[model samples]
Target: MTTPIHITHVIVGLDVGGAERFLLRLIDAHRGNPQYAHRVISLTGKGTLGPQLEAQGIAVTALGMQSLRDTPRTYIRLKRALQAHRPDVLQCWMYYADLLGGLAGRRLGIKRILWGIRNSHFESGGTRLKRAVRRSCAIASRHLPWRIVCVADSALEVHARAGYDRSRMEVIHNGYDPETFTYSDTGRHRLRRELGIPPDSLVIGSLGRYSAAKDHHSFVQAADAAMRQRRGLYFMLVGRDLTRENQALARQIAATPHPERFLLLGQRSDVIDCLSAMDVFCLHSRTEGFPNALGEAMCAARPCITTDVGDARQLLGQGGRVVPAGDVPALTQAMIHMADLDATQLQAMGARARGRIADHYTMNHAVDRFESLYQTAMALPY
Candidate 1:
């Protein structure tokens, strides 16, 4: 019998988020690499990257499911996919992908499955149920011959504490393409004008889906304080479509002093353009594995001020601030300090962030690490 040759990547969705972006990068990096034949499976329907990948002549499949909880059916559909693909290695990302897809892959006799843990402990600690889900992941994960890959050290430690074998887990930082996100003077001015801000106005911005854990409220509070002391400084909150929480945040911002100065630019396609216009970047997320926006902004040479979450401190180093999560007062001070830095100091910090990626976290670096890991993991006798 021919040995089952399966090495398929499985993700939950293809939305315009960090993980989805990573999927695109992973595919593009390894598209022509001779080491393996690759395909992508999205449990949810095709995402924005679907056409892009298909354009590269890579195979893309979507299971057409609605919800992660839409199980048994999801399970059955996934079973069919596994049987058809018959992958030797199944890589599972995020929660639903890790649990359901990992189980399905194992049942289909995939030997070298790897679980991607992208969330942090703080977010997982919110309630008994979420913690229970984490436990379930730990339990379901143990029954299979698998390795765990986390995007940050915190996530690895969390998995280890949850009874995962420490030897089986490693931290692989996420990466971005400098070519795609480099800052341009023209792009900055154009984006600033588009947002109705003048060239001289200090633009402080944050990007990321405005989920509760992103802690955008703290950003509002920090920008509010900074604006009082420094006029003509503007704040833009990017990344979020129309949502009830967005409306609520708008109301909250409107009631604050200098309401008109605060802008919420929802779900931008030209994030690098937006970053180019910013004098300061911020992220107040309560938790994360590694923030793509923060890293991208850094790569774009924007000085960042963020709360300590996920791998922020390690990633930012002297390039940005890392305060305790939800500490509005500390966050405010960090914002002001970053904003008040001398030109030379600010430029130096931005340079530091830019160097971090080139050395350790660019897309090529991340893809190389993954490819090496895959090749090494596959060579093991099962």
Candidate 2:
């Protein structure tokens, strides 16, 4: 019998973001599969998801690098971890990890390396330091890893244009586990009650961290516009730093006619239940790789309205509406349009959304692809 391939994943941190959540799901898919074994290393502080991974018997290590100043220490620790494990494949997530991990893997004579790219665009906001780092990574992408697995086709294209090796790039869309994110009437009722939302009220929801790339301001503006056109509409915003304490978000809410109608639940562990409570899911991201929230909402049988970022339009296809990114007017119109749909039409749209996810983007399908890739990588001569 062939021995199980040990794969080490190096990531920036295990925060509760899309990439972090997706990594946990990927690790879960490999459990009990004798063909593969996994280990994780976090370059910064261990976040909430590390414990969950440890509970599953996966080893997770934190290098405890607080900032750029700690890069030398992080590299030393990562190299030692790699030398100890001597994994069959070293998989790096995000840019910083890819750069550091790839260098370490090469230094240790690891033959097969894979880099995961999770964002379509780098909106550096004119930070010279960030731009310099991105450029350095782009230059390294030309020769470092055996394969670059992009979570979206858009991400591949964007990076290719930015000088990454097109031949080495592979698109692997983020996967959704239907069993975990399925709709629940009870959950819907419970979340609505907890949030003080009327059972019959129309709810439009957006899930993403409060970042410039997420462009929550656009979502807030769209929600405001939609609420102006219709009464009894509620908006749900979920993610870290999305509370009333956020000055920018608070100002946006205060601009709305019915600030009381907005339900800013901030960050919650019950994401599935929160998704179930929504009448419509919205993604107004200015940039994305592949949106986990959009897929989760689809799996929860909620129709979505998303911007034309990453592979969102392809993911939605005919199942949901797509608008131009950062377009407040278009997003507002889409929100209003979805709000006006009759119960039957909305149900039909949601069914299509759910069907699309189940047919094309299940966790099993993603795991199969990943396993095949791993096998191929393992077969290559060291």
User: In candidate 2, how many Å is residue 51 off?
Assistant: 0.4
Candidate 1 lands at a TM-score of 0.92
Q: What global local distance difference test value does model 1 have?
A: 0.79
- Per-prediction tally of clashes: 2, 0
lDDT of 1 by residue, 216-314 (tens): 887888888887776677888788652335677887788779887887778877888888888888888888888888899988988888788888888
The regions of model 1 sitting more than 4 angstroms off are 1-6, 122-130, 242-245
Q: In candidate 2, which residue ranges exceed 4 Å CA deviation?
A: 122-126
TM-score to native of every candidate shown: 0.92, 0.97
**After TM-score superposition, what is the CA distance of residue 357 in candidate 2 from its true location, in Å?**
0.8
Please give, for residues 1-382, the per-residue lDDT of candidate 2 as tens digits.
7589999999999989998998999999888988889999999977989999999999999999998889999999999999998899899999889999999999999869999999898644547776777778888987789999999998999889988888999998999988767999998999898878986799999888899988998888888888889877899999999899999889889988999988888888999899899999999998888998899999999989999988999898777899999999999999889988988998899999999998999999888888888999977876
